[model samples]
Target: MNLFATFEERVAQALRNLQQAGDLPGDLDISRAVVEPPRDPAHGDLATNAAMVLAKPAGTNPRALAEKIAADLASDPRIVAAEVAGPGFINLRLDPAIYRDMLRAVILLGEEYGRGTGQDTRPVNVEYVSANPTGPMHVGHGRGAVFGDALCALLAFAGHDVSREYYINDAGAQVDVLARSAFLRYREALGEEIGEIPEGLYPGDYLVGVGQQLAQTYGPGLHDHTEAEWLPVVRDAAIEAMMAMIRDDLAALDIRHDVFFSERSLMAGGTDAVAATIADLRARDLIYEGRLPRPKGAPDEDWEDREQTLFRATEFGDDVDRPLLKSDGSYTYFAADIAYHRSKFERGFPVMIDVWGADHGGYVKRMQAAVKAITRGEGALDVKLCQMVRLLRDGEQVKMSKRSGEFVTLREVVDEVGSDAVRFMMLYRKNDAPLDFDLVKVREQSKDNPVFYVQYAHARCHSVARQAAEAFPQADLSPENLATRAAASQTAIDPAELELLRRIAQYPRIVEAAAKAHEPHRIAFFVHEIASLLHQFWAKGKDSTHLRFVNQSDEESSLERLALAYAIRCVIASGLRILGVAAPDEMR
Candidate 1:
């Protein structure tokens, strides 16, 4: 159903014909040859650089090769004309019937039409939004969550065996801080006058419920224990409660991970898994004791000029060696991370993708180095960095300070604007670029709000179908019976409808390219274009009464347009599904 892929195959087959006719060399490599939409619509419906790519390899002039290819391609009924353009490029003008066929393809394939050959069967593990188990997820975490969840769905649609994962940072000092904060709340819940929370402690009222739950379970027994006796009990309770809150926050946005890994479990019960992993690296000569060079453009504080346990990251594309242990014989966070990734490798994930915030850009190389050193470069790890989100309300900056616990939580934002708006806004820009999230703009139902614009396009299509059903009671254009009619309607199409069908036919190619590039924003951009086209097409029908979807006198054209509208709705719904947003059949 992919028109671009179909055209490329047609071009390749034409080239083989040339080879058999003794007009071109047989051994020329055609792998780099590509057929795509022309940059300018004036050029043609499609263009190819096969002649230019094969000319040098075939030891022939590019212009001559292009002319030969163009002549051969023109023989196909689908290609009305092929002309040689600048620097041996072949511009192809497809016959109007080809576009008609494309429209028919959309009607026939419906939602499944755009899914490509994807990963076939490669198992992929995507880990994202692994926020420390200290508090509720904030707006920044929302971007990563939306991006990761969409990516997992995209991969799954592309036929990959995908598993979504979240790694909890439970074995850190932050969790201890959470425990103390929760303990204070627990005391306050038991009718104790636990005064103002001290500085450097969690100050959010979200922990009040956790405290009440602890009081219900332990009553007054927790107050009698010392720090050592109560720390473990309290820490465990706090982490569980925090994770539950986090899960709820994610569920609010329709996001759920298949696995939640705990860092504490990697070394719990005297397992020393981190040390064991380091030993394995050391045995392979990838670990050593060395002093690291001071980081560039960073303040030099406590320049410890002594040898320490280091990983030979340089051998695996790292700029400098990385520390695996601290001076106090404790595992560094990097050490624990390495062990965690190593565990993923052991579990047989050939492809692993980690979605991290932009602030961790520097961490990418070292993490990639660790993966290579552990797997001997057999497996691949791709780290995607999502830049910061700047929240604005009513054109004024929405203030946020994590240290002061005054930041907006993801739950709060979703509650205000709904999950559909939140998810769409997060994906409206490239992950590597900073996003300006305007609460006021996103809430608007106009064209500026992409979520509503796209959703409304879907709703409009259904409205057309409903109108057609009322006009022609025999059509039965309900969602359930629309599929069979769509397939039947693919045999004929108008110019405007065909253009939309061409775009619909490109979905699989778009998904493959976007997923391969690790760019979810492409999906957003595509949805926007689709919405724009649908709106324009609808406006066209409004002007020409003959072009309207429901013609009271003609059942055949009415059925065709109704089926086309149904096809557009299905594709729009599929794209929205990938973004973790709802596609409404009716706009309220």
Candidate 2:
């Protein structure tokens, strides 16, 4: 169903024929050869760089090889013409039947139309939205959440067994801080008005519920207990409460993780996986006691030359060897993270992808290094760094401060603007770039908003379908009927329909490429392009009565145009599903 791939193979077979005929060398490498849409549609349906890629290796003139390849390709029934264009490029003009058959294939396949040879499935663990269990999720975390969720969906569509994971930052000082913050509220709940929240503690009213729960459970029996006596009880309560709130926030956007792995669990249950991982590394001589460089770009006033337990991360492509334990003999966050990833590997996930915030950019190389050393290069780790997000309204920046306990939560954004807007707008751009999320523009019901525009295309397609059904009640407008026909009605295709088909046919390849490149933003762009084409065609129908999808006088032509519209709806729906956005039948 992938025409480009089909034609690429055709070109390769032509090359092999030339080699067998003794006209070209058999050692020519065709890996770089590609078949794709021409720069200008008027040039041809598809173009290939076979001659240019193989000419040097084959020891032949570029144009001469191109001519030979063109001749061989022209022999194919589907390829109507293949001409040598500028500097040995071959522009292929395919028979219109190829496109008609593609439309037929689309109608026949429906949602499964563009799915490529996703190659069975590979176990991929996509860990995202691993926000600290201190408070509700923030905007930056929301970006990574949507990107990762959409990525998992894309991978699934491309046949990957994806595990949506959330790594709780619960085993660290932050959770203890969360407990202290809630303990202040607990005392307040017990009628002792604790003054302003102390510094280095979470300052949020969300933890007030945890305080109430503590007051109800222990009633004032533990009010006078020392820090050691109450720390675990209160810390565990706060983490559980905060994680509940986090899950609720994520649910508002309709996102759910398959696994919520706790960092504390790595060292819990009387089994310290972190220690075992370090021991394994120590046995391999990758772990050692060493001293690290004092400082780099920032000031480290208390820099010490003390020896610490370190991992030889440099051997696995890290900038420097990394520490496995903190000065207090407790395993570092990196140590637990290494254990978590090693566990993922042991659980049969050889491919691990972490969608992290931009601030974690410096941590990527080291994490990749750890995965390599732990799995002995059998496992691969790819970290996607999501940049900051600036929420804007009326062209003005909306500032927030979580330290002041006043920040925009992911729940608030989704509740106000709806999940569809939040999901689509988050994926409208590449994750690596900073995004300016305008509150006003995304909700606008105009072409200015991509989400609205793309959804409108799907709506418009269905609207046209309904109209066609109403106008031609007796016409055989079933997908089987319309698709089985040569044209919509045997009428010559307007250039617009041809252009739309070309773009429609590009979906399968786009899915495969985006899945391979790990970019779901490509789907957003493709949907928008399809919408624009449909809109252009709809606009054209206003001036030309014959261009209108409904033809009361010619039922066959009407069914054909409606068939095209239905195909467009199918594509937009499939593409939108990949983006985790709904493709409504009507744009209400």
Candidate 3:
């Protein structure tokens, strides 16, 4: 199914044949030899660096080795010509029938056309959008949620056992602030004349719902209790309410996590798991008591020269040892995170990823260092930081202040545009770069919005299929008939037809490269490329009637072209699905 892989295998077999015939050195290593598409499409269909990679090992000049490999490759029926290019790269021009056969593969496979097998051996966990349960999710969390969910889908499509996770920071001080805020609302719900919220408390209308719920449950009967008796009761109530709101918000954006890990659960029982994890690292001499020097740029106000429990993060490339416990003898946030990661490693996932906001960029090295110390460098942790999002409306800023509780939530954005538009626009940029999301621009029907452009391509293909059915009443267009039809026209290809097939053939390679680089933005770019090709091919039909899909005179030729269009539509749908975007059958 991977044309590039197939071509590389053929080239390797040819090289081995040469060695067996004593035409080349027998001791050369060709593992690095690879075949890929040429950067410039006009150069060739595919290019390889077999000779260049083997030159020094085989004790031969690159150009000489390239010419030898070219002669050997030209012997194959699929290869029309193999020419030696600059230095030792071999540019390959394949028989057009090979591309035609690939189009048939697409038609036969449909939405499953480009699914891969390399990821079948491992399990991956992608944890993201773990924004605190204190408030509704904002635009920043939207990007992380989309990226992590799309990454999970991509890995799953590529055959990995993928799990989407969200870590709930319910055990932190922020939730206590939330509880006190809700308590005030609870008093107000009891008809007390509570004044404006104090300086250090949460002031948002969201807690009004939680307060109302508390009022419905307890009424005025719970007002006489002390903070000690009522804090835990209302804290749990407030967290549940806030989490319910968060889940609804995520649901609006079409994101769902398989696991929701609670930080409070790690220390709920008599056994403190954070202490247990630190003890495990201490046994390995990774934990020590030390005093951290003041940070280079800014110093903490309460920082004093005193000995404290710390993790030896410097051994794993961190700037300094990180504090494990705070001044009050309570575990720091970093300590809780260490236990969380240990729990992940114990669950047997060799690879783990945490999607965080860009403000947490400085925390990456320390978290990585902690993972290394816990797993003794046996586990992997990658932190993906999503930069800020600037919202604009009609080219003017859509202003909102996080401090004022006036910012638009993720749910509102999804409700305005749609889940498809929100997911596509969020992933249209690299994770580390700041993004400008224009509310006015993304809703447009023009090509400026990539979501509409790609979806329009899918819709056009469906339109072609509908028109073809009317033109060729005898052709079977159902999935059950696709196999027989694919077998019938396996070797039929035109110039424009071959171009569309080439894009389909590149799908698996793009998936593998993007997965390896941990870059989901590549998926957006690839979708754009395929959409461009489909649009160009569609436009060509307007100028040349012979290239059109619905030929009134020849039923067979029209069916064949419809089959090709169907294949392109299948590829577009599969790619769009992986990106968590919908491939609509109609634009309106």
Alpha-carbon runs more than 4 Å astray in model 3? 21-28, 300-304, 401-404, 479-493
Estimate, for each residue in 350-373, the C-alpha lDDT of model 1 and write its tens digit: 789999999888789989989998
Worst 10-residue lDDT window for candidate 3 reads 483-492
Error of 1 at 147 (Å): 0.6
Considering TM-score, which of the candidate structures 2 and 3 is the better prediction for this target?
Answer: 2
Instruction: Summarize candidate 2's per-residue lDDT along 56-94 as a digit string, tens digits.
Output: 887789999999999999999998999999889999999
Colliding pairs, model 2: 488-560
Whole-model Cα lDDT of every candidate shown, in order: 0.84, 0.88, 0.85
Q: Score candidate 3 by lDDT.
A: 0.85
Give me the runs in candidate 1 sitting further than 4 Å from their true place.
21-25, 300-303, 400-404, 476-495
Model 3, range 560-579, lDDT digits (tens) per residue? 77777788788889888999
In candidate 3, which residue pairs get closer than 3 Å at backbone N, Cα or C atoms, i.e. clash? none
Q: TM-scores of all models?
A: 0.94, 0.96, 0.95
lDDT of 2: 0.88
Give the residue spans of candidate 2 off by over 4 A: 299-304, 401-404, 486-489
Candidate 3 at residue 324, lDDT? 82
- Residue-pair clash count for candidate 2: 1
Best by lDDT: 2
Model 3's TM-score against the true structure: 0.95
